[model samples]
Target: MNSRTKSINELILTAKRDGRSVKYVSDGYHTFDELYYHRMILFSVICHANKDRAWKSWLHDDGTIFNDTFIVGIQTDEGQYTYHYKTEYWDMFQVQEVPRAPKYDGHKPKDITRLLTL
Candidate 1:
């Protein structure tokens, strides 16, 4: 198995032993309802390499596939956003710094919205 896979496996073992909940968010504004212990393990492996960001594995609820890697980016009012899957894959387990989305008129959209919404 490749190093990525191996590291994921090891992470899985550790998470299972620790019993921590694993959370994953996608760019499309979707979040995992609840992640399995093993899945959290895989996430930990990815996080280890990408400390500045969060990582996730896209797997069927039944745990059939776990090859896809998702990296966390900026969080918004909607929810946490992730980098494109292709980008994450091409980086070879490297975490890409999520560019701070351009600010609008010296304030972020969320900041503006927060003021208005509240």
Candidate 2:
């Protein structure tokens, strides 16, 4: 609906298409609608991952929905991304972009920045 939600939806969709599980945990929600929306998103992702795709059976089951201060790391071909969403009233969230680091073979040295400094 909103820009933030649209971005989140895009991220979730990308993750789903790539056959990756999205880690979504919220500290708290201001309104019931917010909570419900989050839950539905989570459910959709989980269902997409499931083979049967029948997650409604467990909807009424006992379980904890949200956790406080849970950190999630997402790994993609581009790089690793760490997402954190703290307790905010409005539709606000933080996405920390981390560029992919160069790989090292260990035999030959790569990224001579440290060597250059010395």
Query: Which candidate has the top score in lDDT?
Result: 1
Count of steric clashes across candidates, in order: 2, 0
The Cα local distance difference test for each model comes to 0.41, 0.36
Q: What is the model-wide C-alpha lDDT for candidate 2?
A: 0.36
Candidate 1 lowest-lDDT run of ten: 98-107
* TM-score of every candidate: 0.21, 0.23
lDDT of 2 by residue, 1-118 (tens): 9998898778778988998765543335344446655754553343244323121211111332134422223332333222223334112222232232122223222432222221
Model 1 clashing residue pairs (backbone): 11-41, 12-41
> On residues 35-86, what C-alpha lDDT tens digit does candidate 1 reach at each position?
3334444534544544554433333224333355433333334334333243
**TM-score, cand. 2:** 0.23
